[model samples]
Target: MSATARVLVDGLGVDTVCALDRGLSYGDGLFETIRFVAGLAPLWSRHMERLQHSCVRLQLPMPDAALLLHEARSVVGGMDQAVVRMTLTRGVGERGYALPTTAHPTRIVAAFAAPAMMGDAYIHGIRLRWCETRLAIQPSLAGMKHLNRLEQVLARAEWSDPSVADGLMRDTDGNVIAATMANLFAVVDGVLVTPSVERSGVAGVARAEVLASRAAVHVGDISREDLLRADEVFLSSSVRGILPVQAVDDTVYVPGPVTRALQRHWRGLGFPMEQA
Candidate 1:
């Protein structure tokens, strides 16, 4: 943790995690990164909904939402802007892959200073590259924000050029999945389309909000060609709100009307997307 960060383990202010925690040992956990603006988490409900769903899927006991939020708020301390990352692990257990007969889930909520606003990227759009590292197909873990993120870590390591905002990743089958950290969307022939996360990738809270909007968005498979030929492209994430894609590799894109409209919509929801 950095000097500007505060952490709470199980509702107590703490700076260290137990060495034997399952999350550290086996990556057996789920996490959420929430954006807090003016002491409130605008997408808090969506994040909690996803976390609850993942807990049920992984058979981990769901923590009380009110209690969790209380702890998260306490750590954030009413910052004007901040990022709250909450992790829930199966906790200490006996050696090996066996699940403990009695499980005590460890809840860690950490708050960090929000990243500086990406003004130019949000307005003029951003450049991206294609990552050689591909996501593995794991239907069981698909759409869950599990602790296992070696693939994304490797993909992000492929680039160090500050000009490149992020890298687009593919699944093992070579289908376009998502950016290293954000959900992807494209406007194909005036219709909005986003790749299906059923096979791989996270179903981001920002992406869900876009889908819930009045815009008719198609959720399905998307290929490299699909994006290259699309009229517009953008990436969505809870922290960054929405960012238009100016280019991917050599293929160029103009931030289209759809992208701008959504940016306004996102701002209206209390997540800032700087005006173009």
Candidate 2:
């Protein structure tokens, strides 16, 4: 694990960002948390596609995908395992809501040590809390990996217990959105039911993979009652992959056969399944 984070700003080696940057001021940006093993991000194309879509939606200049990938590799060096965070922010702008005519987006790519989770988490599953911080319904920002994460930050702050893996979040309409840092999925009967990010939450890469798989998957609305009544519950992310949820608030669920099957599939895809 690297003790220091390697960072590149605008394709150049830099560690500092301007205070006037729109991302810092108004969270006008998009970011992706990626997992790299053997100096390669397995879902590089997906991340790029999402980033491009975000750029178009936000009217920010899109960074060169090839250049960004090259810089990402340079930051990773020869690290066997690492987590790369890519932040693309609308460059320095004056204090106002008005759009800046001269927008030079800043691309900050950094690599840090991949987090080590306890192996027991994958086996026994982890507990989750029900966050009171409800996500606002903003269809324009829905499903994009934008940098406005105050909602997630507040939800994560609701719990301090290290035993708690994450917190399940909901929209203002009381519809289940996802976990604070991952996408939520529940196995009902033999089908996988996940919340649609059309109104809130992120469209996770791991969640995308699961939806694309041959498994019986359904994307639609999910309520808190539905989650509690499900046979199995799990969270998916690019870095964390599929994490079985043993409990959410008072509801308890053991990692069922379906959760185990997905875990095996992830491991087969060359992800490091072993908990640190």
Task: Please count the clashing residue pairs in each candidate, in the order shown.
Answer: 0, 0
Cα error, candidate 2, residue 266 (Å): 1.3
Clashes of 2: 0
Tens-digit per-residue lDDT, 1-276, candidate 2: 224999988877879889889999999999999899888787888888888888899998998888888988999997889999999998898889898989988889999988998788888889999999999999999999998899999999898998888999999999999999999999886688999999888998898888877457888999888887899999988998889998887888989988898888888777877655
Best by lDDT: 1
Winning candidate number (TM-score): 1
Compared with the true structure, all predictions reach lDDT values of: 0.91, 0.88
Per-residue accuracy of model 1 over 153-190 as CA lDDT, tens digit each: 99999999999989999999999999999999999988
Whole-model lDDT for model 1 versus the true structure? Answer: 0.91
